[model samples]
Target: MAGTGKAHLRSSDNAVLRVEDLVIEYPGRDGSAVQAVSGISIDIVEGETLAVVGESGCGKSTLAKGIMRLINTSSGSVNLLGTNIAALKGEALRTVRPKMQMIFQDSISSLDPHLKVNALVEQPLKVWNRGNEEERKAKVRDLLTSVGLDPEVVGDRKPTEFSGGQCQRISIARALTLEPKLLICDEPVSSLDVSIQAQILNILQDMKERYGLSLMFISHDLSVVRAISNRVVVMYLGKICEVSPANELSERPLHHYTHALVSAVPIPDPTKVSGRAVLEGEPPSPTNPPSGCRFRTRCPAATDKCAAEEPQLTYAGNGHYVACHHPRA
Candidate 1:
C-alpha cells in the first residue's frame, strides 16, 4: 500500500541524504524484473540516524545499496549533500565516493584479510590521497583508538585473526578514515554476541557525534533501532509503510505491517506479556507482487478497497506518517 508522496520527508535543506521516488529493479526468477525498491522517498537530517526495518525480503538492504550506488538503480534521484549522486557518473562519481561509505553485515568478509589492520584503515585515505604517508598513519591510529582498538596491539594483524567484534571495529575505523558525511550500515552488529553488539553500537554513537555523520542503518533488530535511531522507516515488500520518530513508532505504530513488526519485538520484562500481531503465511513474490496493497496477502484488516487502490503515505499527526487503508490510529 505504498504510493509516491513526499509528505513524510523533511525540508531538503535540512537533510544530508534525500531520496525521491527511488526505484531499483533487476532480473529475478524466470527473467522477470524484480522491483527491489519501488518509489521510496526518505531523508536523513545531518547528525541523525534513520533506521529501516522490516521482514527479510522487504528490500531494506536493496534500498541502502541503491542509495550508495553500490548497485545501479533503474530510475530516481539520490541527493547527497545537495547533489544528486544517482545522476553523476565517471570521474564525478569517483570524486564524491569519499563522502559516503558502507559497512556490510558480515564484518570479517567485509574487510580485507590480506592487509594488516593499519593498512586497511589507511587504505581509503590513501586511495583518495587525503594525506601524506605519516599523516595517514597518524589518522588511522586515532580512528582505531576511537573505536576502542589499540593500534599498538592490533595494527599489524589481519582481519581473520581477530574476533567478529574486533573485525567490525576495524571496519568502522576504515569507514571513518575519510570522514564521510554519510554512512550506510547493513546490520553491522547483527552477527556479534549481545554484549559485543552493545559495544559496537556505543562506538557508532560516539563516532557519529565526533564526526557529525548522518546514518542510514538497516537492521532487523528493532530494539537496536529504537535505541540508536532518531527516526524509523518501516518497509514492506519494496515500499515504505510508515515513517515515524523512533520512540513514537515503538509506542504508537500505525500501519498494519509496522504494527506486526513492532509487536514481534520481544518485551524486556518476563512478568508482563505483550499482545502479538501474528502474520500468517509468507511474503508474496516481488517479481509480481500482489496488486494494490502488497501487505494485503498477510494483513488482517485488508479489504476490497485495499485490493483496488494503493494507499498513499499521509500525515498521521505528531510527526508520524503511514500508508494504509486502515491505519491503527
Candidate 2:
C-alpha cells in the first residue's frame, strides 16, 4: 500500500498539477525492478504550497523528477496545467516545460559555472523568445533585485565565484525568469545555514505570491515543511501514509507513522528533557518491499490483519487522510 489516497484530491478547476496512480521504477540488481514511487496520487491547487516530508531515500526527489518528466515512469499520468506530461515527447514536452520549473537541492551544481549570473537568468527567456534583448536584461535585473541581489554587483560574476546561498538566489532568479505557473523545489533550503534557510524560504513565499504560482516543496525537515506549506504529505518507504493540513498534522496526526514522524521533530524547549523514540527500525529495501503495509514492520500496533491486507487511504475529518490499520485519530 502506498501513501495518502485520492480522498483529498480535489476536482476544482484551479488545480495546476495532478498525479494519478503514478508508479516509478528503476532497474535493480540482477535486472530486477525497484519501485521507487508506488501508486501515489496527489494534486496541487493554484496558489497552494504542497509540502512533501519524509526520511531520506523515501522517494521525495524521485517524485519531483517524475512530475517534471526528467525521468520516465513505468505507469501513471502526470497532468500539469491542463496538459498530460507523461504523454509528451520531444517538442510537445519542450513546449510545456516553460510553464513548470524545478529548483534542485544543489545550487552550485545546478547553475552553469561558465555562465555569468545575468546570462544564466536570461538564457531561458532568450531561448523561449520571451522578448527582445533589452527586455530580457531588464527582467533579469528585476528578478535579481527581487531576490535581494544587486545586478550591477553580481550580474557579471560566474556561479563559481559566489557562495552557496548566492548561487541559490541566482538559481531562483533563473527559475523565475520563465515565470512558470508551477515550481517544484527539492530540498531547496536544506544545504544552507539556518539563517540563510529562513531567508530563502521567505523569498520563495514572496515569489509565490508575486508570481501567482503553486509549489511542490520536498524536504525531510518537518519544521520547515510545516512553517511554509498549506498541506503536508508524509511518506514512508515508497508510499505516502498520511495527508493533512500542516497545522493539523503537527497537532493531531492520524496515522501512527505520521505521529512517529511528528514526534521526531526536535522541540526547542530548554526545560524539557529528551523525548522517547516513538518510531524504531529502518525502512525496508524498495527492491523487495514487505507485503501488505510497508510500515507494519516498524509499527508498534501491527497486527495479523496489517500483515495480510494493505490499507487504502480512508478519510478522517477536516481534510485529513491516512492509510493505516490502526490510525491514531
Candidate 3:
C-alpha cells in the first residue's frame, strides 16, 4: 500500500511543473478553429495548490485537460516532472500518464454506477499490476479507510447507492489509487451542496497533505479557492489574467478583470462591505476572441492600449503576477 500522511515527495528545490505559451484549439466547420486556451503559461512549485479561477467557458477545464494530455495542444509546451508532455507519444505517453491524474467536476458522471466500490478502487492497481489479487483487495480497503469511508460497508456497494459527497470521496479514492504525484481537480466541489462542499474541501486538504500532492485546482468559487489554494491563477477567455499568492490575490488583485471578480466575493460582514461589481458583459466567444486583451470588453480600466497590444505576465508584488497593460496596481 502507498504511504499515508505527509510522505514528503515534493521537490521544493525546483518547479515540479512548467507550462509555457500553451495553446489548444479545436478544428471547426468551414476550415476554422476555436482556440480554447491561448498562449497561457504557469509554473507549479512542488507541493503547492495552484487554483485556476474564472467564469464559465473561460478554458480552465481545457487547460487542465491539456496538461494531462487529454486534449492535444495546438502549440506550446507542457513540462511536468521534467518531461515535455506535448511531445510524448504512444508507450512513452502511457508510461508518463500514471504520475498525473484528474478528478472531474461531476462525481455522478465520473463514477461507474455499475461497478462496486471494490472494483472502482482496485481498477488502478489492476491496470498497473501493482500487486496480486489479494493484495489489490487489501489496498482497496485501505484506500476506502483513508478517505474516511467505512471499508466494509462501502466496498461492496455501487456508486448509485451513495450521496453526492460520498460519491466524490469515492472519486478521490479512485484518483489516489494510482499514487499520482500531480492531481488536477476540475471543479471538484462545484456540484455539491453548500454544507457538503465544506466537508469535501476538508477531505481534499487532508488528502493533499497526507499524500504530499501537488494540485492544479480549477474552480469558479473564489471563497473555496481562497480557503484551499496556496497560489492562484485567474483566466479570462482562454488567457491568464493574473497569478498570485491566494491571500494576496484575494486582497490585492491586479488585473481589472481579477479586481472585478474579487469585488464580487461576498464579504462576511454585510454592513462592512457593499458595491459588488457586475462586469459589463459576458466573455467573448473563443472562436472569435477579441484582439489584444480578451477582457477589454468588460474591464472598466480598458483603454486604447489594451485593445491594441496583448500583455505578457509580469511581476506585480510579492510574487504576484498580472497580464494586463493597465493593471490596478
Candidate 4:
C-alpha cells in the first residue's frame, strides 16, 4: 500500500537522502525470507532530524542497517546524494560509505575496549588513509574537543576506563572522523542515564547545526524522538503506521498504533495522570505477521474491516499521514 504522508516541514530544495519502497528480509527455512522492513520510504532533508519510532522489534534498527547498506534489501532503493546505494558495489560502496556513518546503541560495543580513545577516534582516518601519524593525531585532538571531551586525558584512556556517556562521545567522534553528511543513529542515547542522555542529545543538536547534517534517528522512546526530531515516523510490525511533524504527532496522533505509542510516553506530573491507550499483550512476530493490519490484534478499536483489508497511509490533514481503516482523526 502506498503511504500518503506528505512533507509537513518544508522540504529542502535538494533532498540529501531518499529511501523508496525499501524492503529488507532475512533468510528463512526452505528458502523463504523473514521480512524485516517492508516497503518503507522516507526523505532526509539537509540539517534536519527525521526520527523513526516504534516498539521493540518493529524493524527500526533493521531499517537503519538497510539505509547504511549493512543489510541487503530484498527490493527497493536507497539514494544518498543522488546515488542509488543498493546498486553500489565494491569500490563505489567503499567510496560512499565514509559519507554515511552510523552511531550504534551500545557505546561499549561500538568502541574497541582494548584500544585507547585516540586510537579508536583515529581508526576511521587510518582506514580512509587520510594522513600521516602527526596529522591523524591532530585530527583526533580536534574531534575530542568538538564533542566536549578533553583531548589530553580521555584521548589516552581506553573504553573500559570511561563512563557510559564518555564512551558514547568517543563513538560520536569516530562517526565524525570522515565529516559525513548523513548520520544514522540507532537509539544512541537509550543505553545512557537520563542526565547523560540529555547531554549527548544536546551535543548531537549542536553538531547537526554546525555541520548541516541530515540524520535518521531510530528509537523506541517517543519523548526522546519528539525532543530532537522535526518529523516522526511511527512503525508497527515492519510497516509505517503514521508520519507527521514531531509536535503534531505527539499532540494528535492519527493512527491507533501511534496513539498507543504516544500515550505510553511517561508524564512526570502526578496530578496530571495520563489516560494512555494501554496495549494488550506483546507485539506479534514478524516471522508470520498478522493478516490485514498487524496491530489489529492489540488495538482496542479494531473493526472487522481492520482484519480483512489493510489500510494505506493517507493524509489526515496538515500533511499528517496515517495508515488505518479507522483512524483516530
Relative to the true structure, candidate 2 has a C-alpha RMSD (angstroms) of 1.3
Worst 10 residues of 2 by lDDT: 272-281
Q: What's the residue-level lDDT of 80 in candidate 4?
A: 89
What does candidate 2 score on TM?
Answer: 0.97
Candidate 4: pairs in clash: none
User: What lDDT tens digits, residue by residue, belong to model 2 across residues 266-305?
Assistant: 8789777755455777788887888889988888788988
Off by over 4 Å in 3: 1-13
Ranking by TM-score: 1, 2, 4, 3
**Winning model by lDDT:** 1
lDDT of 4 by residue, 180-251 (tens): 999999999999999999999998998898767888899998899988999898888888888888999988
**lDDT, candidate 3, at 135:** 88
TM-score for candidate 1:
0.97
The estimated TM-scores of all candidates read: 0.97, 0.97, 0.94, 0.95
Q: In candidate 1, which residue pairs get closer than 3 Å at backbone N, Cα or C atoms, i.e. clash?
A: none
lDDT of 2 at 95: 93
Clashing residue pairs, candidate 3?
none
* Per-residue alpha-carbon lDDT of candidate 3 for residues 48-96, written as tens digits (9 for 90 to 100): 8999999999889999999999989999889888889899899999998
For each candidate, the alpha-carbon lDDT, in order, equals 0.90, 0.89, 0.84, 0.85
The C-alpha stretches of model 1 lying farther than 4 A from their native spots are none
